[model samples]
Target chain A: MEPDVLLSVRDLRIAFDGVEAVRGVSFDVRPREVLAVVGESGAGKSLTARALLGMVPAGATTGGTIRPDLSDRRGRRIALVPQDALSALSPVHPVGDQLAAAVRSVARVSRKEARARAVAALERVGIPDAARKARAYPHEYSGGMRQRAVIAMATVNEPDIVVADEPTTALDEEHRDQVLRVLGERREAVGAALVLVTHDMDVVREHADRMLVMYAGRLTELGPADEVLARPRAPYTAGLLASLPEHAPRRRRLPALPGTPPAPGALPPGCAFAPRCSLAADACHATEPEPQQVAGRLVACHRWADTPDLLQEAYRASS
Target chain B: MPLLDVRDLVVRYGTVTAVDRVSFSLEAGETLALNGPSGCGKSSTALAVLQLRRPDGGEVHFEGQELTSLTDRELRPLRPRMQPVFQDPYGSLNPRHRIRDAVAEPLRVQGRRPTPGEVAELLDRVGLDPSYGDRRPHELSGGQCQRAGIARALASGPRLLVLDEPVSALDPSVRAGVLNLLADLQDDLGLGYLFICHDRAVVRHFADRVVEMREGRVISGWRRP
Candidate 1:
């Protein structure tokens, strides 16, 4: 029955002191699925990912039941491939030893076995001279190589879920492609769920099966990656999709949603996006918009159902 | 005139050559993007141009002056002419310092006392509210903090802005805002930009010319559409 969702998080909320950073956010990630969490800075996508792994930073505190369905797996519930590769990799430790240590730390594996597995993982990620490169410190490896090293560590344990939080953010396009290719291959080796939290629509479109849109501290929309992108419902989601440079209208003023995103501490009571949302009404300001089924997508907006294909029409009509 | 010119630029950290024979020029009022994989020396090249890091060899001519040979005291006057906006805004600015002080530092460093009126104008240009001036780095969002960094870069009236992975650290959505702001600022002030990044999409969309680097070398020269 639908392979029993690997991680089912509901009504998740994270806060810094009393101010909400992730307010009543929820989503499900299935086995062998890459659910892309797409949002702008301060949209709470990272906080949500951190919540799942129980790895929020010192100042942040969370409220959520991250019930990982790892009964069928042999390793940790989650492994994180952080955005900064150089900082993520220990400068003093050799890349190979670090990766091998990760695999062994997850469970019971002989040091020799883990080292061999580390080499295999490195090879799988397309690192040339895997065995030799393993002994090199972080300073010796290039940016792209270091990123691959991090990915190899995360997947070496064959964890149930991998939280790739902006894993390709620092690398150039070519290196980004290489890292993504490695992650795709690793998914085949270990039937793990991947939650790729990023802001790049191109990345989510290329690699993810499903997508969740976040604004301020709450979820705005959720649906298939392509489907939601093709027909975004929430006004904030529509605005973000339209604002991507590739999707912009030539020689025309961009369809910019005016007003800066609200500070997490000073967010409006009902809808966090009401300030910049053109379609926002009084109802949006009076009460919170719970997730409602609109055109087979879960959208958290009061008037989204009525605006069927409005975003698509707007994008099409722009040019 | 090229706002900034570089030829055979090389920077070394002990025995390791971080940048090797890197050369590209940002034309006056034109954007030139430098794209390459990490450790390709894009950021190092930018820093050396600012003389934040002295190059072991090469020429960095800004506004028709060779910056490489200038001493710290000699370079003081030219420092405001080419300012750097770092990849990480968090690391670039002091955490305890208010946004106003951070943005105003360049002006203050140049021996000009910054008034609230001038700081407000700077904030307005970068799309940050003047109200945010009192807040520290921790109070600002990644995008906002970055815009504040840009304000700092612009405060001293630099003719050429060297943005080293400026928006790469920002979210995709916030990137558009920063880019559009840069474009608008360029149009208004006719300021030249050396947009150093790895994302070809960003380079293609924002820059007038493209330069690619590989292993600290300029593998491809400038190309314009």
Candidate 2:
């Protein structure tokens, strides 16, 4: 692991009831970097994020090492901003108490000091009237306000790493942008790495510094976000980008990938995505291709060089 | 005349007005998308148009007929012409029933036993295999279940489909496919659609006209030029 890297995950695997939800995956989160893990619903993106915080489901066995830079503390050095903020927060208590609780767990601060810090944290996350609103219960806040409070709670102590799993999924377009902006600001303010797990390609393109694309519990592509969006090396990644209606002509048919992802424990032999890949060759069906370094990006495909042109042509045709 | 015309529609719950004087028209074979944030009254306006919930005030005209003034019995005959495709296909479908039975429901409701060919054809039209008719909703993926919902809506031979966030619940990989399928169906069947959505990108791409709602009112509407 690099000296500057805050979190290094190596050969991470998670399984439930002998079903491998996250097959051996390895990645790193550098200090002050936003690494987005992007994929569909069954792609194990959320599972990977959960594993980093050691919050995987009960009975789900995990393997491999997660080395988070904890030179400053002993316990968990990471915090999580869950998808549904309303449900994640305690409904019975005022929002201020939850924030103070998170702060107290991380530090040995006095109660009054913790409460003042809670209000400051809420203010940092762009919540207006922080002190007064902090006194309101979770139910009293709007969805966006609740999400902001959750973000405040997560970043109260300025952990070394933050894992936000679909944090803006439940919000509307306006709130989605607001939450994302607030997350970016808080990450920069705290100088902490952020692992954003979401299915929205547009969000990844806009906010992520680097992106890792997953399919069937395996990483298919990993690279800088802008480069990956402009020139995807994996067929799945290209198909996902092209499938967005915003990328295609107004009335043209979207380039949708044909089949759904394979279910866990029921994955087919060879590459799991071969059935849906339009460019799949005989070699692709023979065995799963290992991640190969190509063009400064890690891509697990037999024909990475050929994908950019194929997808570029499709995108151009749409325009 | 337009296939469906809604004028100054208002829907209220107690002191709170969910939809305030929303007016729009859906021509035959046109898709009119209503875009807004959560709690913005777009869904309420759609429900009011369908008469699923009675409007406090305003007019809804279907084929020159005033829907707001109709009684339940009076509206029964017109029900076949309008159908709704809800957000969660899994929640909308019957868990224990087979796919064929679910798709055949409208036909049965109309006093006709669906034939094997009819069920297979309906499934095929939605891009599902005929063999899938034997399976239950739980056996299918989110995308497949959504297709079944569309097929069920089509079973009624509706001229207009009020799609409430139809593809939002599905994964992005399958969302485009469903949207394309909806577009194709509109072209082939000359169906009008009142698409209720929170996604601005989808409204821009899929709808012929775009209407934006916020704070229980229609803010502005425009054609997709």
Candidate number achieving the greatest lDDT relative to the actual structure:
2
Q: Which one is best on DockQ?
A: 2
What is each predicted model's overall lDDT from 0 to 1? 0.82, 0.88
After TM-score superposition, what is the CA distance of residue A167 in candidate 1 from its true location, in Å?
Answer: 1.9
Q: Report the TM-score measured on chain A for model 1.
A: 0.93
Per-candidate TM-score, chain A: 0.93, 0.94
Off by over 4 Å in 2: A69-76, A308-311
What is the overall TM-score of model 1 with all chains considered together? 0.86
**Model 1: CA > 4 A from native:** A1-4, A15-20, A53-78, A84-111, A135-140, A249-254, A263-265, A305-319, B69-74, B94-104, B113-116, B129-139
Best by TM-score: 2
Q: Compose the digit string of candidate 1's lDDT tens values, residues A74-108.
A: 33557888888888888989989988888877768
